[model samples]
Target chain A: MVNYLAGLDAVFLALADPTRRGMIERLSRGPATVGELGRPFAMTKPAITKHVRTLEQVGLVRRERIGRIHRCTLAPEAMRDAEEWIERHRRFWKSSLDRLTRHVESGDKLTLALTEERDE
Target chain B: MVNYLAGLDAVFLALADPTRRGMIERLSRGPATVGELGRPFAMTKPAITKHVRTLEQVGLVRRERIGRIHRCTLAPEAMRDAEEWIERHRRFWKSSLDRLTRHVESGDKLTLALTEERDE
Candidate 1:
C-alpha cells in the first residue's frame, strides 16, 4: 500500500509538468498513436517518448503495440489512490472541525475547569 | 488564473518530498513553534525553516512571529484550487465515460448509419 502511494507520488510529480498534463488530457479523449500524439508538441520524439514512459510507469497511461505503432490510452484509476489519500485526510479534517465546532459552542467546560484548577 | 495554477504546481511539487509531507502532517494537528516542530527531525533548524518557508510560499502553512519564535499553522484552503482543478476534469471524464457507455448500449446506431451512408 505504501509502495502504491509512492508510485502515485511519481505520477503526481510527472503530472506536475504542463506537457505531461497536456498529454494526459489529450489521451483522455481517446487512444492515439505515438506520432499522432506528438504532432502538437515542439519537443523531439525521444523527449515525448520519455514523457509517455513516465506516464506509463505511474499507470496514468498504457501503451499498446499494434503493428508498427504504439497507441496510448488514459488510465482512469492511476490517480485513484492519491484521491483516496486526500479523501481519507479530508474526513479527518471534517471530523476535527466538527468536534471543534461543538467544543466551541459548549465552551469545552471540562477543559476550562481543568485549566482553572491548574491555575489555582 | 494560470499563475495561480503555477503556484499550485510549486506547492504540489514541494509537497512531493517525504520530509515536507511529514512536516505538513504534523502541522495539521495544530500550530507549533519552529524548535518544537523540528525536535523530531534529525535535520537542522535552517533545513526545517526552509521546508516551512516552501510550505508557507504555497500557502499550505502560515508562520506567526511572536517575539523571536515562529509558530506555524496549517492552511486548509491552500490545496482547494488544486482540488478544484482535478474536479473540473473529473466531470469531463465522467461525461465522456457516460457517453461511451450510452454509445455501447445503443450500439452506436447513428454512427453506423452515417458510416454506411458515407460508404454508399
Candidate 2:
C-alpha cells in the first residue's frame, strides 16, 4: 500500500480548518503581515496567531519576524504533494471510468450483433 | 475572506488520515466490495468500515449494500471543491509570483541602464 503518512497528513490537517485555509488564500495573493492576514476575520490576534502557527508548522506558510512584525508568505511548494495526490486520484478515476464505458459499449455491440444474427 | 467551511472542511479532514487516503486510492481504480477494500490493511473489518464510513460521511465515498456485501465506490465529484480550492490558490500564487518576477526584472533593467550611463 502506498502510504502518504508524512507531510501530506500535516498539510491536509492544517488545511482542514477554515481560518488556515483563508490565511492561505490571502497569502496566495501575496505575503502579508500578521495583522493583515487577520484583517477579514473577527478572530482575536491570538486566535489568528494560533492558526498561522498551524500553517507554519505544516510548512504551508513561512514566517519571518522583523522587529515585532511577522510576515507570512505562502510556501507554494508545500502544497505540491497534496495537489499531486488529488490529481493522481482524479486521473485514475477518470481513466477507469473511461475503460468501464468502453467495455460497456463493446458489450452492447456484442449483444446487438447476437440479436441481429438471431433476427436473420 | 474565502470561507471553505462546508464540504471542503470535511473533505480535507477525511483526507488527513492515511488509511482513508489509501482507501480512496484503491477505489479510484474502480469500486470494490468492503472485503476487497480492506485487503491491504492489517486493521479489523470494523476499523476499515469505520474509515469507510468517515469517507462516506464526507461524501468522498459512496456505499451501497448488495445482499450481505457492501460496495464502496469513489465519489470523485466530492473532491472537486477541494481541488478547486488548491487550484485557485496555486493560480493566484503563481500569477503573483510572476508579477513579482516581472517587477524585479524591470527594476534590474533600470539599474542596468543607470550603470551603463554611469560607465559612459
Q: Which prediction has the highest lDDT against the true structure?
A: 2
Error in Å for residue A105 of model 2: 8.6
Computed on C-alpha atoms, the DockQ of candidate 2 is: 0.31
On the 0 to 100 scale, the lDDT of residue B13 in model 1 is 75
Give one digit per residue, the lDDT tens place, for model 1 in B16-62: 66666666666555456666666667898899888888888888777
Mark the 10 consecutive residues where model 1 chain A has the least summed lDDT: A111-120
Write the residue-wise lDDT of candidate 1 on A72-98 in tens digits: 767767666655544554445555456
TM-score of structure candidate 2: 0.80
Model 2, stretches more than 4 Å misplaced?
Answer: A99-120, B1-5, B98-120
Per-model DockQ? 0.19, 0.31
Model 1: chain A TM-score against the true structure: 0.71
RMSD of 2: 9.7
Fnat scores for every prediction = 0.09, 0.62
